[model samples]
Target: MKIQLASSEADIERCYPIVARWREIEKRSQFVRQIQEQQKFGYYFVYLEDDRIEAIAGFHIIQTLARGRVLYLDDWIGETSEYTSGYSRILFDWLMDYAREHSCQSLRLNSSVRNIQAHQFYFKNKMKIEAFQFSISV
Candidate 1:
């Protein structure tokens, strides 16, 4: 599999169906134009194998009061059939290498509470749950 920057409409289309499912659950277009606009300063990667999209991962380089300069992973989704098939690891490993090359302090992500399997994957991958994310809707 190869990781490539998803800049074209076709690339985004490849991710739309899978990401739309997540957007329905989350009640927002997590990777819409606003987020894509932010990609100008960061990275938006899609995994491809045999001319088909396997997964998508987006990250942004940002400075936060707590984490400072870090690569914040905004979203990741793999085909259900490909889940736990090592594609996720490959994508993450590529992101890690990318981060290292750019001198990022850390990689951060916010996983929704509903995504239990994803949490387990993160744990298995040696990622720690550093904090609980709380939110209030106005």
Candidate 2:
């Protein structure tokens, strides 16, 4: 297995399919392109095994009034076979290391309310349920 921060147009291509697969709830090519343009703000890390892309994790360092400097995980998805099988841990550890290197104070993510399995996974990983996130569609 190999993990590396995606850094090129090709890398963005590698990430698109994974994002599309996991986030079929929405489709926004322009948003994806915006994310690609802002690679300096965060990274799309790809996990490759046997020359196949198995997972992708997107993370960013953000400054918040409440959280201060923190690492915000935007999206994380692994092939179903890889879930609960240590691949998530590996990807998280890598993100944590990257956060630490950048002096981030904490790591946070908003798991969709419907993703019960993801909530369990986060709990198992020792992440605390911090607060409720509310959104209103504009």
Candidate 3:
């Protein structure tokens, strides 16, 4: 297995399968380009095994009064059936390791309140319900 920040257009192409589960694939290349080039805020990382992308994480570092320096996990997805598997845990552990290496005070991600399964997974990973998130489309 190999894990690294996804850098090339080809890398983004390879990421399509895992990410397409949540978003439209036709728009993916453009989105990946924006994240890799236009945004100064984040990086997209991919986990590959036997040359196939099995997971992807999009994260950024941010400083806020409440959290100090933190790792903001904007997106994460793996093989749908692998959600509760050891592979998912491996990916998550990797993300946490990244936070520690970067000196981030906290690592956070917002899951939709309706995602009960994901909530359970978060709880299983020892994360607490610290705050509720609210959002509105602009």
- For 26-79, candidate 1 gives per-residue lDDT tens digits of 423554554466666666655554456677787778877887778888878886
- Backbone collision count in every prediction? 0, 0, 0
Superposed by TM-score, candidate 1 places the C-alpha of residue 136 at a distance from the truth, in angstroms, of 1.5
* Residue-wise C-alpha lDDT for candidate 2, range 1-138, written one tens digit per residue: 788777776665666665677665254565467666667555555544436677787777789898899988887888765558677778888888888998999999988899888888788878998799999999
lDDT ranking, high to low: 3, 2, 1
**Model 2 regions lying over 4 Å from their true place:** 25-34, 40-50
Better of 1 and 2 by TM-score: 2
Residue 22, model 1, lDDT: 56
Cα lDDT of all candidates, in order?
Answer: 0.74, 0.74, 0.77
Task: Provide the lDDT at 124 for model 2.
Answer: 82
The lDDT leader among the candidates is: 3
Which residue pairs in candidate 1 collide?
none
- Decide which is better by lDDT, 1 or 3: 3
